[model samples]
Target: MIALIQRVSSATVTIENETVGAIGPGLLVLLGVEKGDDQAKADKLVRKVLAYRVFADADDKMNLNVSQAGGSLLVVSQFTLAADTNTGLRPSFSNGASHQDAEHWYQYFVQAARAQGMTTETGRFAADMQVSLVNDGPVTFWLQV
Candidate 1:
């Protein structure tokens, strides 16, 4: 499992011109599941994401995790993140998980976050989504487990 997380002041996901998910002051999580990714990997990744200290603290340092910073989460499925781009110009999707597996893990990840009492919003799995966000500090990180 992999996640590309961005600190955002606000974010939203739209499908067919209808807003589906939105959040204020949070991390925009672009989640990806690889061919062998399972519940354990998903669980580990979820824990890392929630505990990552990207938010600024009172001393003006990046020391606070999302919950402590009073932030929510906007998770979006992004299979492309698992693509193999090291060879040739065209990227390969051979490393990505199957559709069913991907969707299952995606939902599982979201539920795990919510189960931890985190405010989490999500993009429709396997849908054509349009996402927009105001990236706070333009801070981003690529995390994998």
Candidate 2:
């Protein structure tokens, strides 16, 4: 599983002109599921996402986790993140998990986030989504598990 985690002051996702998910002062998670990724990977990634310190502290240093900073989470499914673009101009989806598997893991990840007592919002899987965000510090990380 792969996650492109971005620190955002605010973020929103829209589908067909309807807002489906939004968040303030939190992490925007663009999730991608690859072949062989399973529940264990999903669970580990969730834990990391919650615990990873990307927010600034009193010292103005990056020292606080999202929960400690009191921020929400906006999780969005992004199969394209699994694209193989290292070689050709075109990307390949061959390494990505099947649609069924990807959706299952995506839901599991979201549920796991909520279970951790965090405010979590999500985009519908497989939908054409328009995502907007004001990236805090423009801080971003690509995490894999």
Candidate 3:
């Protein structure tokens, strides 16, 4: 599993002009499931994401994790993150998980985050989504497990 995480002051996900999920002062998680990815990977990645220290502390140092900073989560499925772009000009989806497997893992990831007591919001799996965010410090990280 992979997560392209961005620290955001605010974020929202829309589908067909209807807002599906939104968050303030949190992490925007662009989640992707790859071939061979399973529940263990998903669980590990979720733990890393929430524990990632992108938020600032009293001295303005990056020292606080999302929960310690009192932040929420906005998770959105993004199969394209698994794209293999090393060859030619086109990307390959061969490393991506099947639609059914991807959706299952995506839901599992979100539920796992929520179960950890983190406030979580999510975009619909496999839906056409429009995501908007104000990237805090423009801080971003690619985490995989």
Clashes (backbone N, CA, C under 3 Å), per candidate, total: 0, 0, 0
CA deviation > 4 Å runs, candidate 3: none
Instruction: Write model 3 residue lDDT over 42-79, tens digit each, in one string.
Output: 88999899999999999999999999999999999999
Query: TM-score per candidate, in order?
Result: 0.99, 0.99, 0.99
- When summed lDDT is taken over every stretch of 10 residues in candidate 2, the lowest stretch is 80-89
**All candidates: CA RMSD (Å):** 0.5, 0.5, 0.6
lDDT values, one for every candidate: 0.97, 0.98, 0.96
Instruction: Check candidate 2 and list the clashing pairs.
Output: none
Give the alpha carbon lDDT tens digit for every residue of 1-113 in model 2: 99999999999999999999999999999999999998899999999999999999999999999999999999999999999999989999999999999999999999999
Candidate 3: 10-residue stretch with minimal lDDT: 38-47
